[model samples]
Target: MPTPGFPPHTLDDEGSPIWLDELAAEDPNHTLHVVRGLDPAAALEVLGAKPQWFQACELPDARPDEWTSLPGAALGAEPGSSATLLAGRVGEWTFVYDDFGATDHDSTEALSADGRAAATSMFSINADASLTYAVDGKQLAWINVDDLDLAEDLPGMPAELRAAFTAAGVVEFDYLEPGDPDYAIAMRAACALAGLACTLDDLRRIPLLVTPLG
Candidate 1:
């Protein structure tokens, strides 16, 4: 089993969290950039997992094997040629992204507090928010005000936040990174949609995994 050991990713200049807005500014010709963060199963390809699959992150609706290669685009660019790899660690989880392949990309976006995955188990939340957690997927776990014991699988959050969650009835809460699976992701999507922008201090962000709930 993959151990949870990824770390918080940061930017070189401002020391802020690595984000998409920065990645999108890579080139002038590259007007559209699509990214998505895959789950453990999806990440196996990069972690020495064999037999690969490809797709254009921008065209999720497109055929699975099809990719619209754009000239001067990073994906189509030569290997190691100005290829920007953004990433971080959160235990055994290594979250990363390059504007290259489609499936390895973190394109699953948030309707609000917009987000995507840079790599496995590490999701990037563009906005601040709250979340709910449950051990049963078929059942719905409402956002409660109690603290949750999330040491086993939920290894990303800080000890302080975990304590808060335990007291607040929250079993899940992280600064939703860009790589987390969409299943049970972004609980307050509507909140992000209602308001154009909300500061990190204003709302609650949570990273909920449905697998454990199931």
Candidate 2:
């Protein structure tokens, strides 16, 4: 039990935890036990002032635990071959941005209010196209407007873009033109070019009717 006079780690009025004190009270013996048999260099190296080597390896201070990424990262094996580039997330549940940029997608998007989605990371294609296919650890993807049949032929798309298609099927592209509806028609046309089945209804949902755009 903690001392009655002593207090729990401090919190700000906003309730942020004071982390410094918590570290001091933690069991160093337990820490050593967890890291035992592992290289001391590796353990101390992660938080140290100087670089170190282990087993002839000059390891980088790469934050493997963070949501790191490279721009233009794709969702599949082919990646940039045909697919457009976008932002990416590389943490536990990896996901790639399917060019979900706004101003080009025709509407200002705010994700569903229930907190199910975030607009900064979510988008639907314009009226005529669909993101049909993707590849990654998370496996999020979209079928083209014309490629919906290919979607069925190849594999399943993840839930995000699939949900978007139930409403619209245009992709977000970097080169969204300046004007009304942004780049919708052209973007949708590109998606339609793929010949994938994307929509059954103007609003593609509820027993999604998939006819091959091909």
Candidate 3:
């Protein structure tokens, strides 16, 4: 069976959607956030999206590559200044994606005000990647893939979360080489524990709410 995770690591894994691979290849500099218990609109607000500019769009239309042609693409003060965010609810979690790492660690606390929130970032241009989680308005854990030795679970972290981390072999992350698929495996496990399992098809078929960063 294909390994369970975002961006399936297996070769010719028919079980996984093609979009996952497409996303990993086409957008190397982006962030994917999953927040429990919040709908698309609520998640967007928590992530600091500008409400007035919000609209519903399909994944292709909202792709960051196409933002240059979006209605408000030129509204920013400078030339070629535009930001786009796409969010949708999948199962119990709201998934948000942006071209850059817009959701920082501090904002994650607010994203989990009612439940939990998990974010995974990949910025190949800067060779940066990180995973962050929060629960009940409190930041619990943050791990930069390049520095796994510095990761430590917080006091209030849920038992299931710890188990998920272990199952994903997070402790071995330090030894893995750059561009390893295990990094994504660990991220998928963490988000899965929070009830956030998303396939690329979900993004393509679902009507995600779109907005600009305020």
Cα distance off (Å), candidate 1, residue 211: 24
Q: What is the C-alpha lDDT of each candidate?
A: 0.25, 0.22, 0.54
**TM-score: which candidate is best?**
3
- Against the hidden reference, what TM-scores do the models get? 0.23, 0.18, 0.68
- lDDT per residue (tens digit) for residues 1-214 in model 2: 1111112333212111222111111211001001112232322222221232212211122212222211112121132133222211212121112221222211111111122222211223223433322222121333343434423523353454444333223223355322212212222222222221122121112211111000
**What is candidate 3's local distance difference test score?**
0.54
lDDT of 2: 0.22
Error of 1 at 116 (Å): 20
Least accurate stretch of 10 residues (summed lDDT) in model 1?
205-214
Best by lDDT: 3
lDDT of 1 at 148: 22
TM-score of 2: 0.18
Our tally of clashes for model 1 stands at 47
**Using alpha carbons, what is the TM-score of model 1?**
0.23
What is the alpha-carbon RMSD of candidate 1 to the true structure? 16.2
**Best-to-worst ranking by lDDT:** 3, 1, 2
